[model samples]
Target: MRLLLKNTKLLQTKEQLQTCDVLIENNRIIAIKTDVESTTADQIIDCRGNLLVPGFIDVHVHLREPGGEHKETIETGTKAAARGGFTTICAMPNTNPVPDSIDRVENLHEKITADAKVRVLPYASITTGLQGETLSPITELAKQNVFAFTDDGVGIQTADQMLSAMRLAAKAGKAIVAHCEDNSLLHGGVVHQGLASERLNLPGISSVTEAVQIARDVLLAEAANCRYHVCHVSTKESVRVIRDAKRAGIKVTAEVTPHHLLLNEEDIKDADANFKMNPPLRSEADQEALLEGLLDGTIDMIATDHAPHATEEKALGFLKAPFGIVGLETAFPLLYTNLVKTKKVSLRQLIDWLTIKPAEAFQLPYGTMEIGKLADLTLIDLNSSEKIDKQKFYSKGKNTPFEGWKVFGIPKLTVMEGKIVYNNL
Candidate 1:
């Protein structure tokens, strides 16, 4: 399968844009030039002056396949991801049975191959069954193609337990992704511990609940000499911790979500469950710090943290309801519309964060438009404008807070390995 994309503006790096024709043969990019005639391909796309980018890669996503299919499936979730311009998504291990063992990891691979339209990478659980007491088959799971290990829904509460796991992961050369929550400190709170919680008369999750874990995990990773990652970073204090860790030469990388960057406690009102999530959104000061963190390169990448819950589950008020929202379908538009189109960040810089930085962090070779690379690609319609329609979501979950967000710049087409997987047309 050979294909030619014409008049494409490709983002080569944070500060570079290379406009050319990207010729792909089978699954790898073969040529990038000014004028490639249509005779050398099976198909030729005009591109129509759209940006041709390496497909977006999200390091954090929840597919909910094994048991929570009522909320999401690899099939439905990846469809949403492809639509959001993502080519590869690293799935969380907090499934029903959990991908803790090698067999479970292998099962996820098989399921992804059979059901997913986009690439579905797995994260083996850091603790077996996520009980936080016993370690899963870390080395064996890593050998079986797990992108990283994470007990994402919760952290290993015991310092000793986490240290032991870190040692093993370090020895095995695996990336250990921390959910960074202090469970002992959590009293089943549903909002950030701040003025909002005080006003609403609700229990809240303290910023320290996430920050303390990050402080400890950074030192632990430094001690163990391992690649450590913090997921869904939401607080300014936490960002400061991560920045200090990076400056001191620890293998620490972190991700901030679009919602966290754009919305905060001020945006939540009247007990809306859509605004509720674990490590609940913080204040304006914290949100400003997050934007600063992203702009100055203190944060490594952007991820969706695309957790989805069923409607019945989310209807139980704010405190009793599950914490999450649908993210895959809305991430790109929200990020591009808010960050790039508004000039908060350069377009090239946004592309680099969405692709190259994630590729560099996970050691995945899928985020470049260079020749001989895999042809995972996203074509954007920079001028398209529409309101978000949650009623027609591909995933079973409609738990988004961004419903009717009048945003523009959506992925008009997404192609993986030279095959058109999603086309808005």
Candidate 2:
């Protein structure tokens, strides 16, 4: 298949946004120029001077297949991702069989291959079944096609266990994407330990719970010399820890979710489960720190942590409901609307965070629009505005906190591997 994109504003660099035409042949970009004739390809798309950027890449997402299809599947989740302009996503290994063994990993790969509309890279658990007691076959699993190792949703509690896992991952040359949390500091908490939890009379999760574990992991990572990534960074103190580690030349990278970057604890208007998430919404001070972290390069990328759940599960209320909200369908719009449109960050910087930054962090090759690269790209309608309606979401999970929020930067078209997968123009 050959496709031509014309009259598009190509996002080339932080300061060089220029109009160009792109030609894709089969699965790679063949040419990029200021103008190309319409008869050069089988299909020609007039971008109408809209933004043409690399397809968004998410390093953290939860496609609840194998065990929890009630929430989401590879097919449904990737479809949602395509609508959000993402071409590649990484799946967490917290499924039915947990993907701790080679057979389980192979089984999950089969499902992804048969059902996924976009690229889905799966992670293997750092510990056996994410139990935190025994280490999974890290050396063996690293030989497989998994992107990295993580025990998301639950942090490895013991220092010795985590240290052993980090050493193994370092030896195998795979990243240890950690869900940093000190369970000992969590006293049956559900939300951030602040005014919101106090007013709602709910148990609160302290910032120390996340920061302490991150501090410990950074020290361990420096010693192990491993590629370490922090997931859903939420606290000011955690950001400080990561910033210091990077200055000290540690191989550390971190991601901040859109909700964490845009909403704070004060933004939680009521005791609703939609506003609840792990490393819960923090204070205004913490939100400011997150923004600074993102702008100054302490944070490496933006990940959706795209956890989804059934509506009834989330209807259980703030204290009793699970800790997550669907994000894959809303991340780009929210960031572009709040950050880029408001001038908090440049449009090129935002694109790098969603695309090249993640690709560089994970060592993946899908976030570039260069010639000879994979043709994964998206077109954006930056001038349009739309309210976020959950019913319009492609994923089965409609539990989002951003319902009814007006946002710009809507995705108009999505192409993966030189094939048009979605078109909203």
Candidate 3:
């Protein structure tokens, strides 16, 4: 099938914009120009005053398949991703049986191929069983096309173990995605260590809880000379550590979540479990610092860290509730409504953070809309106004803190590989 996307403004990079027409033939873009006479094509879409940008890519997502299907599945997750303007999403491997073996990786790929409306890339576990005792079949997993190695639910906990994993990952030519949390320092904490936690009288986790691990892991990556990507960076100190490390010429990369960028601990005063997430929201100062980091290029990408869970699971009290809120469905509008529309960031910068930056970090090639590239594109109606409604979500998980919030700039249509996957009036 051929498709013509007529005159539209596009986010070409972090700060570039252009008005052009894009022609997509089958699964790749065939032509891109400022003007093209109406040629014979199967379909033509007029994107008036809308944005035609490369589809967004979420690097860290928890598709709770192979174990917690009640919370989410590849089909549901990817569908939600497509509606949110994502063409590709990399899954984290802290699942039920953990994706550590060749068979497991292949099984996930096959499942995704069968049902996913968008591209699904899986990251294999760093350790054999994510147990941190022995290494995973890194070389074998790499041969199977695993994009990265990570045990995202927790850190390696030991420097030697991390160093070994980094060395093997570097040799295998794969990126190592890390979840920076010090289990030794983490006690039975349920919320951020701040005035809100004190008022709520819940156990608190300090900012140092994340920053300390960031420092340790940066050193480990430098020593092993490996390409490392930090997952869900949440604190001011952690941002400083990442910034300084990058200045010192370390090959380290990091991402921030939409929640961390827009919300803080004060939001937890209502005892809303959806507001609760691991590396729990910090202070207002931390939020400001995170935004600063993203603006200054200290943070390389913006990921939802879209962790989903059942409403019943989250309905429990704050202390007993699991940490996380579903994000895939709301990431685009939330960011656009808060960051871009509010002028905290430019639309081009936000688009680049979600697209090319993520593709570059994963060493993939699906982030651009140039001719001959995969026809993975997202069409968004930036003027479409909407309010946050959790009941309308496609994912099995209903856990979210943004319920009832007023939002605008929603995605009206999403296309993957020249096929329309999702659309709404």
The best candidate in terms of lDDT: 2
- Ten-residue region with minimum lDDT total, candidate 3: 8-17
Candidate 1: clashing pairs of residues? none
Model 2 residue runs over 4 Å out of place are 12-17
TM-score of each: 0.97, 0.98, 0.96
Tens-digit per-residue lDDT, 206-254, candidate 2: 9999999999999999888889999999999999999999999999999
Error of 1 at 332 (Å): 1.3
lDDT of 3 by residue, 279-379 (tens): 79999999999999998988999999899998888999788988888899999889999999899998878888999998887778888888788888787
Worst 10 residues of 1 by lDDT: 9-18
Clashing pairs in 3: none
> In model 3, how large is the Cα lDDT of residue 412?
71
RMSD of each: 1.5, 1.1, 1.7
Best by TM-score: 2
Model-by-model lDDT, in order? Answer: 0.88, 0.92, 0.87
Identify the runs in model 3 with alpha carbons over 4 angstroms from their true place.
11-19, 34-39
Clashes of 1: 0
Can you write out model 1's per-residue Cα lDDT over 283-339, one digit (the tens) per residue?
999999988988887888999999988999888989788999888888888888998
What is candidate 3's CA lDDT for residue 341?
88
Give the distance in Å from residue 233's predicted Cα in candidate 2 to where it truly belongs: 0.5
